[model samples]
Target: MILGIITDCTHYTSPSGEVCTENHILLRQFKHLSAYFEKTIILCPFGKFDDRKVTTTYTSSNIQFHQLPLVGGNAMKDKVQLLVTVPKWLRAFKMLHRQCDVVYQRFPNNLNIPGFIYFWLQRKKVFATYTGTWSGYQGEAASYRLQRWILRSPFRGPVWVYDEKGKEQGRIRNGFSPSYSVAEWEEETAQVEKRKQRIENGLTTYKFLTVGTIIDYKNQLAIVQACHVLKQKGFSFQLTIVGDGPMKAELEEYVIKNGLQEEVKLVGKQNHVSLRQLYREHDFVVQAPLKEGFGKVPIEGFFHGVIPVINNISMASQMIGANERGFLFDASKPNHLVETLLSLPAQQHLFAGMINKGRTYAKLQTLEAWAREYYETVSAYYNEA
Candidate 1:
């Protein structure tokens, strides 16, 4: 079978003439999914090496990339570029679309305007993965709302959502993004076990990590505020905020002004390999996003045996597993994060069991495993026909 993916994922080329992406998680998925089919055609907006987003390369062995002209941010300036570029890209994509036996369209993207509609019109076997907040959220784009609206009941194929089980919303089903492999999971868990043995003498400094683009909705600032609170109480903790965005400077400013420079570090995006090391070195993964889809970082943290202190989001609630896996805090409540962290040292002893449960849960959430589940289900639909 030939697999065609329509994604809004921006890809950057590397110095060695390789098709690479900063999103190593997506890169792994692409490679794994391509292995299941004779050929995989990726239709996405591609950019040059100067884009500075290169990390891991996508497989070119049995994969063909049909590029779309680079479309940048959601601003009007970015949208205007599409008016002239999208027409030719649509025509090009239509030609590529005919060769695919199945279409896997990742959602809430500018290309989804054409990608989803064209696939649906052609009556192709479409597997839509809504990678954003599936239940909707505040200040969401109309495009996002429109995607959810159309993917409702009787959408002809599965609508993979971030939520656990994706409930009974007709075509909507559970889908999550994964990063680690089986080998990586084993290595991390082994390290976690070793950590339990070493840390029995009791903890010292609490190492917290938050990975994602530095953004307002991501609520990194709130975590910083919590850090300031911890500093005031003379807590021995450091928050390393990984990944860069528009809000990095603002976060840096806050960190410096509040004399939190020593406590909070806004480290820019790291490659997949470095990210694993970061997870291992840290004690806890803290994310309090105002809205989110299924974040892979927590799953990664869990696999690495780091306790996940997540906020009130669907993914967090599902993965917290009645607080046995990790702790959950309300992002809406002011000082809630600070309060949660303050109580952590008191409950530090119970973290090992929680980490074990989290590891057990995350072991099955590897890229290879997710690909197997996705391939089987989507391929079976075609088999039935």
Candidate 2:
């Protein structure tokens, strides 16, 4: 069966960790306005490569969605651009509808009018995986209400959410019998598997790492404050903040003010390989996000057998599960974070145990496994109809 996956700008990468090529017949849908819901996908841009038509059978193995830009021009920027793009997008959707069997969408809501019409008209099955309520991003309460109304429409299909709470809401709010899915990571044992070049425990200090971009939403400042508390209380752990963002300079100042200059280091942005290796050197991982939609860093850390100290939020609560693999602090209460870390009985040893448990959990959900699940569900829905 030919399977077509439709998603927005966010879910960009493939399971194999390669940039999707235009020869892959990937189409990018563009949103018309922040207020209006019309969205359409035209042919992706190519440097020198030409657009390739999709086929039902995978016989044309040389085809790919190569060198296509992930985002079209901002929908609100120019009305002319939006008007011109919609027709091309409609044509692309019509082509895929005739060529492919199933279309899997990972968008959280029915905010794309063109996509909505195409999928609705094609009579092809639609499978969606949602993260959470878009209330925070919708600007105002009325905006969120409007979105909720759209989300509850009957035309949508069986949906999947990251957590049970979200899953339950999906059924009530979206007419979806939601399923739960986990992020996929490589399997690892409690101990780091030694390779050709292994670094001995030569560093005499405990190192902590926090992955993900440095932003206000991530609450890295809270981590720095916790480090200050640890310092005042005589705990001497070194922190390495990975990834870069607008909050870097402010966060650096906070680190300095708290007298943690010697302890905390902002390493800026590192690619996945560097971050993975950095995970090996660190004693644990920490995320202090104000809220999260499935924090993948903890799972990544878990794969590397690094104990993850996560904030107690929806995703973290679901992921950590009664503190089986890590510590969860009440994010509402900032002081609680400091107290929790300070109170750990033999912190390193407790962390090691958590790492083992977390690693085991991370192993089960492979990306290939997730893709297979998504594909099968879409296939069944299309065939049954």
Candidate 3:
């Protein structure tokens, strides 16, 4: 039987007009699997948005986009899958099953129940890969509990996780053992590197960058408030917020209302070229997301030698690593962020050390490495079966 690999919400085209997904945790895993099943993989886009338009990047041999049904505008909740037409999803399912004997899907969200029902009824071998629980959605613990139900399902195959922490979180929430050993991940990309800009007036100002959308949960207001506090302390610095979302109007109002227009810039969403340039230009990336599954911003910022100043939550706390690689702050506390920023310039040498450490870390993870591991796992599974 020809081996067919299937994925949901895993492929993204880069800004350079290449069909590469965002190089976060799940994308890294998908890239690995793509290389492994070079010939038999079929990919589906289950994400809510696709800003870039690079459909041609899929390696021709195995890739397809099965548009996932979007739930209503509000934050996602349970029974969301019921709103979508199952027949359309089923057509994609049937197509995937017909092409290959084994199917692999990155799970959580609405696809869990439908995927399980389809594969079980068809008697197709299925693998459920869990990256992290859906924290972006509205409902709390019960939402995860519902997703975990499929994890314990008999049809669920080898569950792939990024780190032991990810596995533990899944197990704690779902009460299931990880079916396979986890893989090491790093955040490095071959995108065009931005030439470092020289800050002629040096050593006095602390510049921080906040990437991603200006959504409410991103907690950008906290950063602005912190910058205001830092400015009051005679600290000369700027906080450049990259990316745009619906919260733009509200955030702009807040910045103007507080008279922080000079100190904070709502630069709006930038393309990849500009984004890399932003990373190179800033001393560090500030991430204050209220919640995150696994933060790729910190890793991506570190990859470019920009230290990440992240909120103490989710994987950001674990990845910061004893403040050696980056700094973690209480996102809920603006004054704390101000204090950290004030203290950072004094540790210039330390910051340099962290950047060096980040460079070393970046080399350890590459597209080639990710692809190889995924291929071996799939090949071994099919071989044994």
> What lDDT score belongs to each candidate, Candidate 1 first?
0.83, 0.57, 0.62
How close to the true structure is residue 276 of candidate 2, measured as C-alpha lDDT? Answer: 60
User: Could you give me the TM-score of model 1 versus the true structure?
Assistant: 0.95
Quote the RMSD, in angstroms, for model 3: 6.2
Q: Which ten residues in a row have the lowest lDDT in candidate 2?
A: 28-37
Per-residue lDDT tens digits of candidate 2, residues 1-385?
A: 4444454432223444433432221111111110111222222333222223111112232223312223345367555655666665666677667765555455443324456567877766665555553334324345334434444575466565555254455333221221112321433332454410122323245567987778888999888888888889887688999877899999999987877889999987664456667887786688888765567778777777677788887567667868888888886784998887776645544554576677677766444344455545555655676
Q: 2 or 3, which is superior by TM-score? A: 3
Residue runs of model 1 more than 4 Å from their true location after superposition: 51-54, 72-78, 164-166
User: lDDT tens string, model 1, 1-385?
Assistant: 8988888787876778788777788888888878899999888888766755637877559988887788767789877887888787678668766788888888878777676667677887888888888888778888889878777744578777887544755556777888888888877656888888756668889999999988888989999999999999989999999999999999999998999878788879999888888988898999988888897778888888888899968778788888998889998888888999999989978888988898889987888988888898887766886
Q: Which pairs clash in model 3? A: 9-46, 12-20, 12-21, 36-375, 243-269
Give the better candidate number (1 or 3) by TM-score.
1
Question: Model 3 over residues 1-385: C-alpha lDDT tens digits?
Answer: 3445444454554556445554234443443455455455544554332654323244444544545453434445535544655666677778878877677666555555677778888877766555554333455556466666666555545555434254543222221111111222223233212212222224566778998878888888788878777767788888898877788888889789877888889887665556767876777799888767656677666667778888887666557777888888886763787778778766776765677676665554455654554456555655687
Ranking under lDDT, best-scoring first?
1, 3, 2
RMSD of each: 1.8, 8.6, 6.2
